[model samples]
Target: MLPLLVVSALAAVQSLAYEQTLGFNSAPIVETRSLDEIYHAALAEGGVVTFWLGGDEKGDEDAIKKEFEGKFPGMTLNLTTDLSKYHNGRFDEQLAAGHVYVDSIAFQTVHDFPRWEEQGALLHYAPVGFDKIYPPMRDVRAAYYGILTVGWAGKWNTDKLPGIAAPIEWEDWLRPEFKDKLVLTYPNDDDAVLYAFDLIMQQYGKSWFERLLKQNPRWVRGTRTPDTVMQASNSSWAASFTSDGLFPTSNINVSHPVQGSFVTWFQLAAIPKDAPHPEGAKLLHNFMLTKEWQATRGSWPVRSDVEPPTGYPAIFEMPGTNITYFREWMSDRAKLERLRTWFEDKLGSAQGLSPLIDGI
Candidate 1:
């Protein structure tokens, strides 16, 4: 064996190297480095990155693969899109098995992230442009940040309801003339829809839902159904449609509620602690924050420097917009369950799988 002091010194060096590899530090550094620096570092470390995106596996594979590959010639981008709920379960399994494969995650399941942070499953690295992000959209601790803003608002088929005006308030749907003509996503089917109902109840009182129920408004299971119904002119109005500013039909007009609209949980992004390619993940995270990347998305970017697409107002400029803090709701599981039970009792069973719950 080598001398004791020499052996001890070597062991200490090895421990320090291990900690550095794991990104362990007294204060996690906020990544302010340039994209080029991160890119070269990523290339030096095998140049492979994986992202778990929320929602269906629509043609994002080709687009993201093309964009990232074009941007970083030598880097390899592995992109997978699945319902956030399914990804969450998959990630939990990965963590339990100590076999993490994903480098970064961008998803709509805002509730589970806080838990992940608490467990130290997340790497705390604020990407470049971190300071430019909207204050409410980023975590104070810099564990995770909101990259996009999606709103739940009222919409209608203008061609079908030429004589009728879009609803400017929650109570506008309760108009006697609109009875049985309004459609909304079932509150129990989605957390965002449930939060919207809670907001309406809080602002208008408990009897607000009771009165709206009296109108015989149809309740569907998915958020997309309301928008689809409105597009097809099957419903006069949809009460809780997500406005992405990319509707397939021009006849369907979406408007934020005059009284206020709910900014459903922001689509959140974070790096897992055991990511295989931290530099690649960091490079991708920084790239996402760029105005160039944000401008391509239908949802509003969380970065203040990025201008929203023409016709849509900037997030801060929107009047009476309530940002829903999903962390609070997730903490109160009992209340969520109770509310779900109550809604089912009143509105009947939800017809289909909630994209939030069933990952459909």
Candidate 2:
């Protein structure tokens, strides 16, 4: 049996305990200001906002900076991008020091938001489009909301394997021809990637993991590296999932497997109660929900009114996918850490620079 003890405690966010937790207020403080009004208020409060964004690459901050600044002139955004695992610890440390420097946070560590809310650390203000957001994607109290929805899927390079099948299944990569041709992000390093591996293991068991280890897949840090390696034609397949999606002209294709579940989760964002520039933080949160921003995220938007990326259905509407389960999985940190350690023991420690340093 697959460690029933380890997975037994999985709980959904909408469960009564979460919705009615003791000492944690679930009442929302909805924001009534228009984006223009919020922007002007931000300008009066030093016109600067700093967000500790979660990502592997420093370069990921560029586009967001351009967009946020262009939309609200005179307002400056100091956005820092790093792994959420590290960012969460830093956030906690800052709180312990009684100085929360960052104005906002968009992180993948879904569990932290609730803990912060209970500690009375997060601002209870909702963004302008809070009502329009898919209910499950927003915190009941509106201390945080999912800003973007991202999914992970198997990816392979058609150019490298000319006769390869389309929409390759997770098991397909284990074939003899694929030996040493697969690249994967370490499950220990990224929660989304970790959840993807956990799903596969649940379906296929430890025997499957043994077979995979025999294949000698190259492991790296960060979810972006596998796709980057495949794009450069350095690897022909990725048995592990990649967050990148399909493009019309690209030879690389993302697999939405019919035989197994793929993982998707919302990237949650919130403003801190102790933000140095509270007005600017609120402005940035509201800006994220704006149609201009939501439509261009290249992933599913939390708001129902926005159109999804071209040629794809909304993530929740997609078949062979799990959103709620991933949320449950992320909420249980102990289970995640246990599984992460188990995978590391089997796959050996991850080797290589982060995609950020590798210039992906």
Candidate 3:
């Protein structure tokens, strides 16, 4: 619906034209084509509909691919991780050639859509159910929508940071007592954490960061790092980054307004302009935004018609939840890159990383 009609072209393959058929009533039927028919046309016409997915959810990718192939026979899905590391070059090389090899791309970098569109690397392809998309999501040009909205929050030992003055605000992280006792998630590898760090720097400035850096943070490469550190009570304070998780049910406390710290949206998806099988891509996109598929994907549903995933209360946009709006951070890529550099220069070491309790 965003008309993410990104206008980019591909070289490895040729485009296939197929008759489209909507399962709609009151509409004159010209030619309605199922996803299978379109896919077959792509294969028959000498093009492979490649679906590229990025993230840790390999299982979800498998399921999505499975469902897609089930619906559209002969289609192929190619999944990969570490997208952020090479996303810029990966697409740039393909796009600059004036003949790209890849078609649709899915990543957690919500900002990439606008940037790519600006670069004229995206294609516009309106999916089947554009009107049903939520307003916030509709504003974006990319047709692909992320099934799960992510949030940047914190996890810590309540027993350690006890009292009304919870370590909710970024300022709390700099408390003299809390310093030298914190272990946050990795930032360089995970932009979601980097986005949250950007908020801390934006709100508090260098002095605050300098002080927090003194406390030391473990720069481990894992989303579960915070959970691992907090669950063991290794650090009295820690940074929790999660797109999907339950804090209440778990023993560790994840502060969402118990004090401060804003939760920001982390990622989104978009359909490609030169889709070998645009029909299948659109169908899969529609299916993902639907309640039925979200339940299986294990993330917040974008549709108001769908209930939040069981046991979940709200998303990054909900009221009382102060979100930094990761979209804002996308503006200054250099600054983010520098922030990552600063984190490494200041706190990515044994001496800089907070150690577990001495006895333990």
Candidate 4:
């Protein structure tokens, strides 16, 4: 016989499954309100919604704010953009003080969502296209779901490095010709960037890390800084990982190694259980998943029904890509902190103001 506690836990799991089958745990799944209906409902409940977005750019939410407000006039969308690490800490403070101010959040810190759900801080509501979302991208209980996917790959300037083939192998950047011409984001500064470095280390060992440091890459604080530098012809290539959209005219080209590891993860979103404007929050959440918004997103949408932008395949369809690795790595706080500290010890500390604040 199983231990009493173990038996009870099994029973609880069975009960939840039974409830889900009976539609008792499916409010969000069964939602029938149209976006217009939700918008009207939001207006009825005070037409304001405050959202917190996790990013290294303050202007990241500008397009979102413009589209959201344009689609639903008379509604105010107060969106704040900042680093996910800072947002999560401030959110915890608000929850502890019982004064939750923000209505919703979309962040890169994938591990924080589960913690919030466990604390009953999240609203267990699904957006309109929840079922259309990829299986691994959403919570079964509808607590939260991935909004979009962000990826880091090798990016280089075509103008600066004229005849060089796209650097699709991890070892390509370490070549003698590339020395002192690489722009790198400090892995200690961003967990996603750290995960990318972790993948490379796992494949090639610590000696690879030492060799990378020997290349004497110009270190920057934010991942976006590399792209900025490369655009100005200040750097020939980004270190190992970087993010950008596909475009025909762009001089910078993004590529992933054909035979080594890379990193990508969904930027997850959820509403607060104690949101001041619950109706408005629901409206915004559903609005984000609609075809209108998803089509315009630079990153791939979580919905399987939505087509990826031209020149890029759906993330799941892409080879050598797995979203779960980064999430799992982030959840292991002990291991993550140890590796982060080790990197900091070797690189000293990240320097300069946040890219968002400094406008770098």
Give per-candidate clash totals: 0, 0, 14, 0
Q: Which order, best to worst by lDDT?
A: 4, 2, 1, 3
lDDT for each residue of candidate 1 in 262-341, tens digit (9 for 90 to 100) = 54557789998889999999988898888898888776778888887667688667676645465466557789888888
Model 4 Cα lDDT, one tens digit per residue, 1-360: 899866765654343222224445434444588889999999999899999998888886788899889999999999999999899998876776666889989988889888777666777887788899888888987889988777667877777766776677788777776677788888899998788888888888898889888888877887778777777744455333555444424566677776787887888899987899989999988988887688777777788888987777887777666876677889898888998999999998999899887667
Best by lDDT: 4
Model 1 residue 334 CA deviation (Å) reads 2.7
Global lDDT scores for all candidate models:
0.72, 0.78, 0.53, 0.79
Which segments of candidate 3 are over 4 A away from where they belong? 1-49, 56-63, 66-76, 118-120, 139-147, 156-181, 204-211, 222-225, 228-253, 295-297, 309-317, 320-324, 348-360
The local distance difference test score of model 1 is 0.72
- 286: Cα error in model 2, Å: 0.9
TM-score of each: 0.79, 0.88, 0.66, 0.89
- Rate residue 44 of model 1 by lDDT: 100
Regions more than 4 Å wrong, model 2: 1-27, 233-240, 246-249, 358-360
Model 4: lDDT equals 0.79
Candidate 4: where are CA atoms >4 Å away?
Answer: 1-29, 233-240, 244-249
Please give the RMSD to the true structure for each candidate, in Å.
7.4, 7.8, 9.0, 6.9
Q: Where does candidate 3 have its weakest 10-residue lDDT segment?
A: 12-21
What is the TM-score (0 to 1) of candidate 3? Answer: 0.66
